[model samples]
Target: MLGAGLAHAATPEAYDPWPGLVQDIFKSRPIHDGSGVIAIEMPYRAEDAAIVPVTLRSKLAPDDGRRMLSITIVIDQNPAPMAARFELGPDANVMEISTRVRVNNYTDVHAVAELSDGQLYVAKTYVKASGGCSAPAARNADEARGRLGQMRYRQFKRPGAAGGAREAQIMIGHPNNSGLQMDQITQLYIPAFFVNELRLWQDDSLLLAIEGGISLSEDPNIRFTYASNGAKRFRAEAKDTGGHTFRNEWKIDDPGM
Candidate 1:
């Protein structure tokens, strides 16, 4: 949310936005020793500047026989610092997740994970897209306004009844205006409006939650996996910084069954 009297400035082109970000993270959750248990997956050259996919994973030894506790994703140059955060429940085995995000400029994106034992792990990836914020919205401004807060859900079925796990993808129709883009006709900067949080659920149970920022592209897409034994439905709810919310649901009736 924009604070009073805080004017938006021209975007900057910098390589290392992590120092400040890391400092802030440390201030929030101080950790003494952290190593390389985190991993980031992204392309060196994004084929489409509009929707660059990013995946994050972590590998950690059991901490006192307990699993990792939390993971946070940060995009340095976004108007708001935090991009997404996932909390792992005891039954949660979220080794990886994929999503689309906006890259304001060339910068380093960090994935930091915290284990139950209080140890920190970090991984970094460099994304080359620049000035994505100033890029024109995917659809006409009027059209986007009409479809704001709309969302869609899809579930991918693996072969065979015993295929094991199920994967689902959620897409939201949000302009994600970064406050830096100018109206093609009016030539005035569009006000910033973007998703702030997303929650994924399975049959009334929490699967994962993501916190977003202006760094996420317009109409953001997220993919996550979970085990399905044939009878549970998937649900997702998302909220933007402007306080708007959207929800969607999908049922799983395995065709193979």
Candidate 2:
């Protein structure tokens, strides 16, 4: 009966604790109205229930008026809830980012962008992937054990000749089990484990650092753009909820102007 109850549980309420979660991160009062400063991009229906891509863009000004300094993504019903937080660098032109996250059930995912002026802009979208994290590991537990913290990276050069900005994609292998999941054979709950942080660096300079909780998908994939001089190298280091760290690096060829 207990197993049946777990299998047949109703999806949790959508956007629960969203208001408080936004307020806690912004560290100031809330914006009663978020009309024009925020935009959220996500698919209406995910192609694969396991990997849903999301992007958050902030349209705030960059002067003393309102310069965006941070953004947060939250999936309401995940085990740890808070999905990812990104802190922007001074010259960071990264108003957009793409990442995959896990959805325990049908829920609303929120993107909150914060400006230097201490105001928060908010946007949200609903996703339909349910029980994604709780799904069994794609491979056997024993086979997945030794490869847990592995990381991979791929860099793509631009079309022209002179080196300029470039795009890179990083993927880290981790189960990101939401702890609510149970082993199919053993029927025991898998402990909660997920990626905690991912930092992107170019020539030892920080570009973006992401802090995540249990909402990240198994083997999270992140893609973002960065300014690149000719012959520069990029690196990413990630840490999981279980305190395991993995790192990967890539080099960009001469990018045409």
Candidate 3:
């Protein structure tokens, strides 16, 4: 029940509705054929366009020694195609990430990965969703403010894996109201309020930082990895469009043991 896509349109001459959007972000570099190494998953038909879930996974060989460095997500044909960018740290085992975004129309979502050596791989998913950017508000402002900035983390360790790192998931509490959603009573488009930025850390060191926008889901959920096998303090800090900041931490006594 996951939808995935690979660009196998015969040649680069294939017409893209938004021609320069991809090249605009990654100038000069050609998007070579990519498969197996990069994977993307999403619902073929999004139930709610405003908060559609998307997951990207990078299959890397432990011997290859090239850790994932960062990921850039582009939603072609959107008002702002550049949806989000994730900058990861050295031990940032961000090989796989799960988050949500707003898909304004039926278009392709590209997940571009930048490996340690600077090579980039791309995976595309064609999603059929619309009106996410102009949908009605799911909740009122007063109710949303009460649960803003709340976050928590959960760690999961796989058995018999390469063991280079362990995986964990973090969920933040925020209405992420895109302001595009209309308030029924007031009949007004609520001002866009969303998580704008995030930084994940292992103790004092920055593990990764993410830039978010209205495209992100109502409550942003992130799954990533970090060096494991011992105790580590995982911290997450985030800021919202409303000028509010959130800080929280998780203590892993003995991870991936």
Candidate 4:
């Protein structure tokens, strides 16, 4: 969420946010076209503006020798365009990442990848959505409050995958309020309160970490593909804007089998 405050709404025909976004978010760093190095998958038209699915996939060869350091997701038309930044752990070998986001307007969504070699690559996709940032919470206040800070994790085998490839999902229970929505009863803007930081680890080794902001959907679910490191345990820790920290760990049924 580095460029959170710099975003402004712009129509697809009247403006392009990528150039300014590059300067603001990347400090005018050169952004190479990510035609082959990375790709973004998203719907041209979102059925639900508040929970539009987006996925980032890495196309680097295993022997490429340059690991993906981090990826920044930016939705140009959102009030806070910098949705999330994901830092990949060196040993994780994460190949794919999927998450839900709030799209405030019909805009171009950009994914910028910083590789170990100190170069930045970018890919873009356009989405047709509106009013997502100010959309009402998915759950009512009472129910949302009850599930706050709760977390869940699930692992799945990657079909025809090699090199110990696996897919996993992590979900956190949160309202992730954007502060832009008006309370139906009170008619007041809800203060922005969301899980701003999250980290995942396999035993002592780190897997991934996310710096998030108001542009993400409620509940913040993330599904990713990574290579197993033979670690016996999986752990997650999340911190919200309210300063509450939620931590959990699970023992792997089979370590490196």
Cα lDDT over the full model 4: 0.92
lDDT of 2 at 69: 76
Candidate 3 global CA lDDT score: 0.78
The numbered model that scores best in TM-score is 4
lDDT score at residue 54, model 4, on the 0-100 scale: 98
Candidate 2 residue-wise lDDT, 1-257, digit = tens = 98888876865654467667656655556754444776778777777656678877656544436666777887776555678888865554565578877676677777877777677667888887777777776767776776787878777666662224566678887787778778998899999888888888876777788887767777778876655544377778888767788887776554332
Which residue ranges in model 4 land beyond 4 Å of their true spot? 1-13
Q: What is the per-residue lDDT of model 3 for residues 1-76, given as tens digits with 9 covering 90 to 100? A: 1232344543366457544875688884766444655788889899999888888777776677776788888888
lDDT of 1 by residue, 89-184 (tens): 455456667888767666677788887767667777888877666778888988988888888888777555222656677888889887888898
In order of listing, the candidates' clash counts read 1, 6, 3, 0
Q: Give the Å error, residue 232, model 4.
A: 1.1
Better model by lDDT, 1 or 3?
A: 3
Worst 10 residues of 3 by lDDT: 1-10
lDDT agreement with native, every candidate = 0.73, 0.72, 0.78, 0.92
How accurate locally is residue 125 in candidate 4, as Cα lDDT from 0 to 100?
Answer: 93
Scanning candidate 1 in windows of ten residues, the lowest lDDT window is 3-12
Question: Which residue segments of model 1 deviate by more than 4 Å?
Answer: 1-15, 28-36, 60-64, 159-163, 229-231, 255-257
Task: For each candidate, give its TM-score against the true structure.
Answer: 0.81, 0.80, 0.84, 0.93
